[model samples]
Target: MANKGPSFGLSRQIQDKINSKYDPELELILVEWITRQCSSDVGKPEPGKMEFQAWLKDGCVLSELINSLFPGEKPLKKTQSSSMAFKQMEKISQFLSAAEKYGVTKTDMFQTVDLWEAKDLAAVQRTLSALGSLAVTKDEGTYNGDPTWFFKKAQENKRDFTEDQMKAGKNVIGLQMGSNRGASQGGMSYGRQRQIL
Candidate 1:
């Protein structure tokens, strides 16, 4: 049977945007992080086969890639820190908190929120195409050094997401989902969006 699922791709348009917006070193770091995470979670042949460098930097791909490399493990719990590190550490802590609330991880792929409500696969596909799916790997919070920390953050903030908020969330997830799909689209296509069981 033909496998119908979302796939990832590297588009010239996106790559051009990233090249223009970010420094080459930053770009390489982001790409390497994403490629490594995708390669790791998807269990592909090798990291070199994962072409994340050519990806566009329009959405949260950079953040997601970073998260993938450095995950926050025990996300549900919070830690008390001194005021001395407040200026430097607050931002990082907040991001970890947010990611934990979302259960951030590379392998945690997204599905339609209404998947159970859809009567048929095609309907699900339509929803997925409109909203897009995401691979919730690493994000800003991953740098916290513990995947569980981010996971706990995800658990905490799971309810704060509204419908519109969820739609926006899909953009980043879609990119990761695309990576999992591989280069199936070839140069002609950047990614694929389809429903699956």
Candidate 2:
């Protein structure tokens, strides 16, 4: 990627394959969700990979999106836009860390270069999807977009049993626990004869 010159042959193929993973439908969903969350300030991007990448490359909008989900004080301090590569990457890193603290797990997080360099835009989409799912699941009233927009994650279900019920359940054996009622070893023999002690 350092060489901005035109790619060729295998490299071009690889790049195209990577870019192909970008989902246009996912782009529209993410764009609409972001615009709703960030209010009218964050303009909508044209429905395309490059357009989506351009809209969020600087990371300022992402910081705003995540901040808007918070109740009181925002996680990020400064989300000012910058024209430099390192600065942009720094902002992206900050947003990523803030998102992590905001409840997105490390496994669900995307890398800075994934957005900055357009290396894996699908990864960006995945991270946003995870954030949306989390926000919807939390349902703390801070999330701005429509609840249906993001699929709500399932919550843990705990069940408690009374002492009598637990004892009765333990006393009975399930069918899955195989029985030794039949004499299965009657005619079974292999590998040399067994010796009597």
Using lDDT, give the best candidate's number. 2
lDDT (0 to 1) per candidate = 0.33, 0.88
lDDT of candidate 1 over 1-197, digit per residue (tens) = 13435424656555444334323343243334344553443222222212322121111332333344344453323333233434223433343344434544422322221122111223222221211112223244333222331122222334577899888877665554555544554556346666578
lDDT of 2 at 100: 89
Which regions of candidate 2 are displaced past 4 Å? 1-3, 178-184, 188-197
**Model 1: residues >4 Å from true position, as ranges?**
1-19, 41-197
Candidate 1 weakest lDDT stretch, 10 residues: 112-121
Query: What TM-score number comes out for model 1?
Result: 0.19
- What lDDT score goes with residue 39 in model 1? 47
Clashes of each: 37, 0
Q: For each candidate, what TM-score against the reference?
A: 0.19, 0.85
